[model samples]
Target: MTTILVTGGTGTLGRLVTERLREGGHEVRVLSRKAEPYAVDLREGGPALDRAVEGVEAVVHCASTPRGGDERAARNLIGAARRAGVPHLVYISIVGVDRVPLGYYKAKHAVERLVEGSGLGWTVLRATQFHELVQQMLSTFARSPVMVLPAGVADQPIEVAEVADRLAGLAVRPPAGRVPDMGGPEVRTFPDLARAYLRATGRRRAVVSVPLAGKTYRAFRSGGHLAPEQAVGKGTFEEYLRR
Candidate 1:
């Protein structure tokens, strides 16, 4: 069995990916800040990082700090991977990262470039938003009885497990640069999502759609984050709500 190190292994997608790798008969080493077997924080570069990357056949780079420091974290991972001569580096990125004007998206786009040009074998899988993330977003904003949503933006929120499974598949295969993007089974608007949430929880909330401007809104309206032609996920937003 090959040994693989998974960054952000305790996080949502990271946990799922790590479990899948272990189930597939690979020795999975989880990277976290805690005192785990492979505890390494990407932001704090030190000798610990080199040891974390050493001897691992591949790295599933699920770690991120969108709140801040994502670019630096990614750079550290790439540098460590390069120094250790790891064969494959699998990155989980967002769809429309390059097209979107959000700061987090821009940081992710920079990370993508770092991985591609790191001179190491790498694969980047750009996926639409996860159902959990979208649900949380709408639910948090729905508190005041009125759910405000951006008008005309279509989102294909996929299951996190589906993306995790895809990452697991990529972990075992040869690196394929920027593989086919993945999305959910359905394309939906932000208000539609809020409405679904309201119905599912038996909650009463009015959804107010707001028309937004700028390059970000335009990109979202254009469905730059959607991969309808490649929607491999079988789970739907309604089904997710039921669970």
Candidate 2:
């Protein structure tokens, strides 16, 4: 069986990806900041990072932080993988990263570039936001008496497990540069999603829609982050909430 390395193996998406790979009978190496045997921080590449990549047939890069430092981590991972002679690198990115003006999206777009030009066989998959993230955001807003959401903004929140399954499938196949984008089954407005969350959790909060300013908000409002045409993900936000 081929040996594969999965960065951020403990995170939501990464953990699922690692499990899928292992189930497929591949040797999976998990690389994380606190994981045993390969407690590597990708932001700071070292011997440990190299060790994680050595002899691995492919690497699924699921490690990312929206707070910052993703570019650094990706650069370090690329260098280490190159040195280790890793043949394939797969990256997970967000939909509309190039269209949206958020700092996190910009960083993700930059990482996409790095993977494309890293001189190794690489594949990049851009997917819409995850249902968990949407739920978390709504939960944070629900803490306030009134939940404030962006006006006119729509989201297609996909299932993390579905994404992980796709990544596993990609890892086993040859690298395909920038595969088809993946999106959720339904495209719903922020207010709609928030209302669904409130109903699911039995929380009572008046969902307020505000016309947020700035290019990022405008981009979101214009549906830059949506993939209505690529709604290949089967899970819906309502279904996810019930589960």
Candidate 3:
């Protein structure tokens, strides 16, 4: 059994990754701001950060914040991993980070570069958006009688559990430089997805599409964030809503 450290181990995806690693008989350390034994904020890496990565065979970086600070967290983690001589560092990133113009995606792309050049054997898997995120978006819109969605935008929402499974498997394997992109079983437009959510939840709401103006929105409309060729995810959004 190997010792692995999973950053953001308590978050949606990270929590599952941590569980999977532990179930495989590996000693897993969960690093989060509030997690016990390793409650270190990665954004403010210090001695505690060093201790977290110490003696671990690999680190699966799943901790990220949409509000910001992702780049700083990644840098701190990379430094800690390097100091501890961690042999492998695996990172989860979005499929369109390099192509999209969103600030979050830019930070993700920057982190990807850091991981690539960290001098440690590394693996990076870029996946499409998760179902939970999509659900959250829809839920927010559902609060109102009218739902506004981006026009001409399609998303391939993958199952977060499946991603966790893949990350767990990668944590133990030899570092493979950027693996194939992972996507969902089908690509559905935003309006369609929103309608499906309404149907599943029995909520009556008028779904409206608005063409957002910006390079970021344009990139999304152009399907720069999609991975149709890599639609390997098993679960469908409708199936997810049913559950």
Candidate 4:
């Protein structure tokens, strides 16, 4: 069986991918800042990073920071992979990163470019926003009996578990370049999602739509961050809330 290394193995998506790879009878190693199976910081490339990738057939890079520093991290990981002679490199990116003008989106686009230019067998999967993130937004933005959201928007959010499954599948196969975009089963407005969340939690709240300004508003209103036809996830927001 191939030895696969997963970066950011402690995070939401990375943990699921690690478990799936291990269950498949592969030697799964995790790279984290703390001492674990291995310790490697993608942001700082050095002996630790090299050691993590050594003798591994594939590298699933899930380690990413906020938009500003992600490109540098991607570059360092690519260099480490080249040094370790890892055959396959799989990257997980967000859907519509290129279409959105957010700082995080810009960083993700840069990472994709780095992987493409690295001259290695690489696959990139662009997935929609995770259900957990949406839930967090609901919790943070909800005020007592009302939830405020940007006016005029639609989102097809995917479950993190589903995205992890797809990432694990990509890790086993040879690099396929860019895979088909993955998204959730249903399209819901921001306010609707908030209302559903409140109802699921047995709380009564009014969904309020607040018009926003600037690039973030434009991006959300224009539906630049959604993947309508490409949605492949089975879980709905309600299902996620129920769980």
Candidate 5:
């Protein structure tokens, strides 16, 4: 079994990937700030990274920061992987990162460029927004009797589990350089999603569609964040709510 190093193994997607790797009988080393099997911080460059990555065959780079720090974090991790002579580097990025002009997306796009130009065997999987994120959005907007949603657009969201599975599969295989984009099974509008969520939760509420103005709003309206043709996830909003 090959030894694989997983950065951000404590996170949602990272934890899932680590579990899958371990289940497949591979030696899985997790890099986190807190004490664990292997602990390393990307921001703090030192021997810690060298120790964490020692003897590892591949690196699954799932660690990332907020919009501002994402690019820097990616660069640091790439450098470390090169130094460790890791054969493959798998990066998880969001769909529409290039089409959208958001700060976080800008950082993601920058990181993709770094990985592509690193001359390393690398694969980037661009996935749609997670189901959990949609749930959170619903919960946040549905605080009052009226759930306010952006009137202009919709999204095709995927489950974290599906994305995690894809990431794990990519980690085990050789790099394929920018895999196909993955998305949810259904195309849903924000208000429709909110309504469904309220129904599933047995909460009585009215979803109010509010037209928003700005580049962010226009991006959403233009379907910048979805991949309807590439919806590969089997989970739907109803199924997610049931779970």
Candidate 6:
């Protein structure tokens, strides 16, 4: 059985990946700052993270920071992987990171480039936003009586477990650089998602579409973050709300 180390293993998607890998009879290690019991954190490339990399056959990089320091973390992880001679490095990136103007997107794009140039056999899978995260965003707006959403943004929120399954597939196979982007089965406008959330919760709230300015919104409205043709996920936003 191959030993696999999953960064951000305690997070939504990473947790699924780790569990799936273990079910497949592959040895798995979880890496996260809050890691406990069956996991360990990188500690910014300290001994624990370094030792975790040692002897692992592959690494699924699902770890990310909310405040946008993914590039630094990616660099440190790449160094450790190289030193450990880890054969395959599988990274989960966003669908429109290269085109999106957001700061976090820029950092993720940089990490993609670093992995490509790191000289290790690597596979990069760019996926649309997870349903859980999208739900969380909408929940934030649903806090008040009036929900405000971006005027023209659209999203294809895929299932986190589906993405994890695909990542697990990549971990076992030979590295294929930049696979086809993964997306949800359906596309929903921002307002539509907000409305769905309200409907699901049996709440009556006036939904307001606020036109957001700047390059970030422009890219989002332009559909940079969608992979309509891919639609690789089995779950839909409606189904997600039901659960």
Question: Of the candidates numbered 3 and 5, which has the greater TM-score value?
Answer: 3
Per-residue CA lDDT of candidate 3, range 56-159, in tens? Answer: 99999999988999989999999989889999999999999999999999999999999999999999999999999999999998999899998899999999
The per-candidate count of clashes, in order, stands at 0, 0, 0, 0, 0, 0
Candidate number with greatest lDDT: 2
Per-residue lDDT of 29-110 in model 5, one digit per residue for the tens?
Answer: 8898774656766777577887887678888888887636667666777787888888898989989999888888888889
Q: Residue 204 in candidate 2 has what lDDT?
A: 94
Q: Using TM-score as the measure, name the better of candidate 1 and candidate 6.
A: 1
lDDT of 4 by residue, 1-243 (tens): 989999889999999999999989989899877846587667777887888888999999998877366787788888888988889999999988998898888889989999988988999999999999898888887755667778898889898999998999999999999989998998898877887888898777778787889987798789888988887899999999988
Q: What are the TM-scores, per candidate, against the unseen true structure?
A: 0.97, 0.99, 0.98, 0.96, 0.96, 0.96
Q: Model 5, which residues run further than 4 Å from truth?
A: none
Report how far off residue 241 is in candidate 2 (Å): 1.0
Ten residues in sequence with the least summed lDDT for candidate 4: 35-44
Between prediction 3 and prediction 5, the one with superior lDDT is 3
What TM-score does model 2 achieve against the real structure? 0.99
Position 7, candidate 5: lDDT: 88
The CA lDDT of each predicted structure is 0.90, 0.95, 0.95, 0.87, 0.86, 0.89
Candidate 4 backbone collisions, by pair: none
lDDT of 4: 0.87
Query: Where does candidate 2 clash, by residue pair?
Result: none
Q: How close is candidate 5 to the true structure, as a TM-score?
A: 0.96
Model 1, residue 116: distance off in Å is 0.5
Model 2, range 17-89, lDDT digits (tens) per residue? 9999999999999999999999998888889998889999999999999889999999999999999899999
User: For candidate 6, lDDT tens digit of each residue in 1-243?
Assistant: 999999999888898999999999999988888786335444356667678899999999999876866877888899989999999999999999989889888888999999999999999999999998899999999898899889888999998889999999999889999999999988889888888888898998899998989999999999999999998789988898898
